[model samples]
Target: METSRKPVLYSYFRSSCSWRVRIALALKGVAYDQAPVNLVKDGGQQLSSEFQSVNPMQQVPALKIDGITLSQSLAIIEYLEETRPDPRILPQDPKKRAQVRMISDHIASGIQPLQNLAVLQQMGEKKMEWAQRCISRGFKALEQTLQETAGRYCVGDEVSMADLCLVPQVYNAERYKVDLAPYPTIRRINKALLELEEFKTSHPSRQPDTPPELKA
Candidate 1:
């Protein structure tokens, strides 16, 4: 079901979820086009009817590829892993693979969602405080888990889906001004990951739609 047509990613420059997909695409060395969906502009372009048709969830990281459109960052990445296995993101070992999924879920489901833009919008004046609290709590647990599973990357020295989830969540934490001092393992891994070419190029600051003032 492969096609010569390049995949198109619908993304927002500063979106953590979209950034995860960007990292996966870069790591896989898959060339793609971007359809920028300015989440802040025009009262949120993701809410538009046209974009909703692309992803009913109205998410910024919807991927149009292989004659189909896929929503949800992890699912899209898994699809890529299945179709393009070399330079794999998931570990081949069963236990290590389970650990990778566990860490990825810990951040993606347990942490990231709690601080998502829509969730923060609903918190009104309490948004910043709430986001900080959520990230701090999640990072506390993640740090403990990473101490056991991490080896050069999130799972046994190979860059896995967990690493993809970690970098963006850390970005969100910094945006919310959550202190990173307590999460030393997380900070250490993030620093190492940031030095990689794939992570650097996929970073929000370098995105095509990143605001001029925010570009790195």
Candidate 2:
């Protein structure tokens, strides 16, 4: 549990889930090394026996830290928040913390999974339509919720786990061509979050694995 070595993150360039953890690590000032996992190359390097040993689920954004390996983006983030409590990502107030969790789950569980790579791959020619529909529906609900909870960030003024979740989901929405015109609050908050150095550094376009054409 105690070591001098930096954490190792297994990530894919364009994965929203990986981007979330990347943001968390950046915000926490955790200088970790990345092990790029090409989710597309060679029929998904995540499915390879080597990466599968790192995570049986073959998911991106797995973290090796504190003498153990952890998978699932939210789980990895919570571990970081718990272990490194400086500049906290969760709110101190109980109700506000619940709201952050609600918003995070709203995107992470209710939205992103429906439009992820695996699901889209199964949809074939209909993938674009499917991703847009899912994102639009989720954003509709999220915009309403943000109207109540948002100030400068997703919850009040301070950045929380919800902000981390929101930015990447918004990026995915844009990639799928979901119109942001209907969701002013979502667009405004996403814009603010993107301006932050942590979010910028953690962006998929800026990652080590990002292709030359995709670099930003």
Candidate 3:
């Protein structure tokens, strides 16, 4: 972990989960090289034999760091936190840290899976409605949770892992055409998060693999 070598991240731009890791890396000031794994083209490059060898789950947002390949965005982030603690993304206070994990889990597990690519494709004709409804339900709960937990960020005055998780989900919600007016707290938090350089730089449109037309 103390080498001069930069980590390599295999990721896709539109993937919220991938975005989460990207934000974490940026916030930690961990320089990385991106290996764009286009999830859409060629029936998902992530599913290819080579990529699957790197990740049996066949997922993007896999990080090659310190001679280890780590999969799953949140897990990769936790590993980063363990190795690179400066400017920590998790909170120092025990209770606030729990709250951060709570909010992060709610979105990461509760909300994300219901709207992931497989689910969307399975929905077929009802995909739009399914995605919109799923996002609204998740956002409603998230809005309520943040009202009690938020100040400047998801857990408190300082940005935390929860904020990293929230930003990408909000992006996915917007892409799925969910109405944001129902969740003002989420919108406010997202707007503030977007203003920060790390979040802005880690944005999907800014990624190396982002489709040209989708680039902002």
Candidate 3 has its poorest 10 consecutive residues by lDDT at 1-10
How far residue 13's Cα lies from its native spot in candidate 1, in Å, is 0.9
**lDDT tens digits by residue: candidate 2, 15-69:** 9999999999999899899999998899999999999999998999899998899
| TM-scores for the candidates | 0.98, 0.98, 0.97
Residue 107 local lDDT, model 2 = 97
Which candidate has the top score in lDDT?
2
Write one digit per residue (lDDT tens) for candidate 1, span 93-188. Answer: 999999999998999899999998889999999999999999999999999998999898888798999999999999989988999999989999
- Cα lDDT tens digits for candidate 3, 90-206: 888889889998998999899999999988999999999999999899889999999999998887789889999999998888888898998888999899999999999999998
lDDT of model 1, residue 100:
93
Off by over 4 Å in 3: none
Worst 10 residues of 1 by lDDT: 1-10
